[model samples]
Target: MIGFTLLIALVGAERIAELTVARRNRSWALSRGGVEYGRGHYPGIAAAHAGLLGGALLEAWLLDRPFIPALGWPMLGLAVLAQGLRWWCIATLGRRWNTRVIIVPDLPLVARGPYRRLRHPNYVAVVAEGIALPLVHTCWITALLFTIVNLGLLRTRIRIENTALRQAADTTPASP
Candidate 1:
C-alpha cells in the first residue's frame, strides 16, 4: 500500500512537471502575441486532477483494498497506454500543447497524430486510465469517485477546447 501511494505520488509529480513545461510554453507563446481562449477553468481542472489522484490513493488505503494479481497486468497495460497517448499528445502539439488553453490566430488547427482520430484523444486515454488504474487493486472507491469527477470535468473541458479550436479556424485567413 505504501508502494502504491509512492507510485501515485511519482506519477502525479511527472504530470506536474508536464504542466510546468506547458505553462512556460504558454507564456512564451502569449508573449509573442498568441491568442488565448477559454482559460478560466485551468486551475479548476488542475485541482480536480490532483484531487482525483490523491483521492485514489487515500481510498485504496482507507478501504483496505488488497492488490489482486489477476487485474494487475491489464491495469498496467492501461496505464502504459495512457502515458503513451499523453506523450503523443505532447509531441503532436509540440510547443502549442499546454495545460492552459491557448490558441494562436491564423495558425491551422493540428490534425496530425492522435488529433487525426478523436478530437480529444488525450482525454479519452485519461478517462480510461482513471478507471482502470484504480481498479487494478479493486479500489472501487477510488475508481468510482474519480470517474464521476472526471466526467464532470471533461464535459466542460472538451467544450472549451473545441470552442478554441473553432475560433482559431474561423479567424485564420483562407489560403490562396
Candidate 2:
C-alpha cells in the first residue's frame, strides 16, 4: 500500500512537471502565432487524465488490489519505457510540443527522433502509460477503462491534428 501510494505521488509529480513544461511551451508557441485546434475537447482530455490518476488510486486502495510481482514488474518497466518515449517526443519537438494542439502556421512538420518512425509517438507513449500505470498494482478495471476512454478521445484528437497539419501544409509557400 505504501509503495502504491509512493508510486502515485511520483506519477503526480511527473504530471505537474509535464504541465509546467506544457505551459512554457504554450507561451512560446503562442508568441510565435500558433493557432490552437480542438479547444472544445481540451477540458475533456484534462478531466479524463485527472480521472485516470484518481481512478487508479481508488481502484488500487478501495479494492485492495495486490501488486503481483510478475505483473507489477513488467508493467513498471513498460511505464518507464512510456515515460522515456514521451520525454523523447518532447525533446524532439522542443518548443513546439504542448499539451494542447497548437500549431505554428507554415512551419514544416517535425520528422526527427521518434517522429521519424511514428507520427504520433507521444500518443503511443500515452496509451502505453494509460495501460501500464494502473496494471502496476493489478488495477485491471482502471487500466481497461482508461484505455477505452483514451482511444475514443484520441480519435478526435488525431483527426483535429491531422486537419491542422494539412491546413498548415497547404498554406506554406513553396520555395523555388
Candidate 3:
C-alpha cells in the first residue's frame, strides 16, 4: 500500500507539471485562435489513469504481495526518468506543445530535443510510466489494464494530433 501511495504521488506530480506547462501552452494557442479537438475524451483518460493506481493498490492488498524494496526503489527511478522526459518534451515545444490538440495555423513545428527523435515523446513517457510504475510491486493487472485502455486512447489521440500537426505544417512556413 505504501508503494501504491508513492505511485499515486508520482503520477500526481506529473499531472501538475503537465497542467502547468501544457495549460500555458493551451492558453497561448487559444489567444492565437487555435482550434482544439478531442476535449470530450479527457475525462475518460483521467478516470483510466486513476484506475491504474486503484488497481495497483487492490492487487497489492488482496494478493498479499510482498513489496520488493529493491524493485520498488528502481521503479521510482524509472518513474522519475519518465517524468523528466515528459517535461523535456513540454519545454522543447514551449508554448506550442499542449495537453490538448490545439492547432494554430502559421506556427512552426517543434523539432528539437525529444521531438527530434519522435513526434510524440510525451506519449513515450506515458507508455513507459503506465507499465513500469505498476510493475514496481508486480501488479500485472494494473499494468495490463492501463496499457490496454491507454493504447486505445492513444490510437485515437495520435491520429487526431497528427492530423492537426500536418495541417499546421502545411499552413505555416518552414524554418531554415
Candidate 4:
C-alpha cells in the first residue's frame, strides 16, 4: 500500500510537470497568433483530471483495494506505456502541443509520428492511463468513474479541436 501510494503521488507530480510544459507551449503558440477554442470547458477538464488523481488514491486506501499481482503488474506496465505515448505526442507536436486547444494560424496539419496514425493519439494515452492507473491498485471504482467522465470530456474536446483545425486550415493559404 505504501508503494502504491507513492506511485499515485508520482503520477500527480507527472501531471504537474505536464502542466508546466503545457503552460510553456501555450505561451509559445499564443505569441505566434494561436487561437484558443473551447475555453469554457477547460475548467471541467482540469477538475476531472484532478479528481481522477485524488479519487484513485482515496478509493484504493479507503476501500481496501487489493493489489492483485497479476492485474497490478500489467496495469503498471500499461500506465508506463501510456505515459510514453503521451510524451511522444508532445514531442511530435513540439510547441504546438497544449492541454488546451490552441491552434496557431497558417500552420499545416501535423502528419507525422502518432498523428500520422490517429487523429488524436494523446487522448488514446489519456484513456488508457485513466483506466490502467487505477486498476494497478484495483481501484475499479475510480477507473469506472473517471472513464465515464473522461469520455464525455473527450467528446467535447475533440469536437472543438476539429472545428478549430478546420477553420485554421481554411484560412491558411495552400502551398504551390
Each model's backbone clash number: 0, 0, 0, 0
Off by over 4 Å in 3: 173-176
Runs in model 2 with CA error above 4 Å? Answer: none
Q: How much is 173 displaced in model 1, in angstroms? A: 0.4
How much is 63 displaced in model 1, in angstroms? 1.6
C-alpha RMSD of candidate 4: 0.6
TM-score of 3: 0.87
Per-residue lDDT over 82-132 for candidate 1, one digit per residue giving the tens place of the 0 to 100 score: 888988998998888887778866778789999998788889878988887
2 or 3: which has the higher lDDT? 2
Q: Pick by TM-score: which candidate is best?
A: 4
Give the lowest summed-lDDT range of ten residues in model 4: 1-10
TM-score of 2: 0.98
Candidate 4 accuracy as TM-score = 0.98
Task: Write out the backbone clash pairs for model 2.
Answer: none
TM-score of each: 0.92, 0.98, 0.87, 0.98
Superposed Cα deviation of residue 97, candidate 2 (Å): 0.3
Task: Find the 10 residues in a row with the least total lDDT in model 2.
Answer: 1-10
How do the residues 55-169 of candidate 4 rate in per-residue lDDT, one tens digit apiece?
9999989999999999999999999999999999999999999999999999999999999999999999999999999999999999999999999999999999999999998
Q: Go through the candidates in order and give each one's C-alpha lDDT.
A: 0.80, 0.92, 0.82, 0.95
Over the stretch 1-176, how does candidate 3's per-residue lDDT look in tens digits? 77576767767776777778878888888999899977877777778877887788788879866668888778767877988997888778888888788898887677789988898898999998888788788787888999999999999889888887777778777777
Cα distance off (Å), candidate 4, residue 172: 0.6
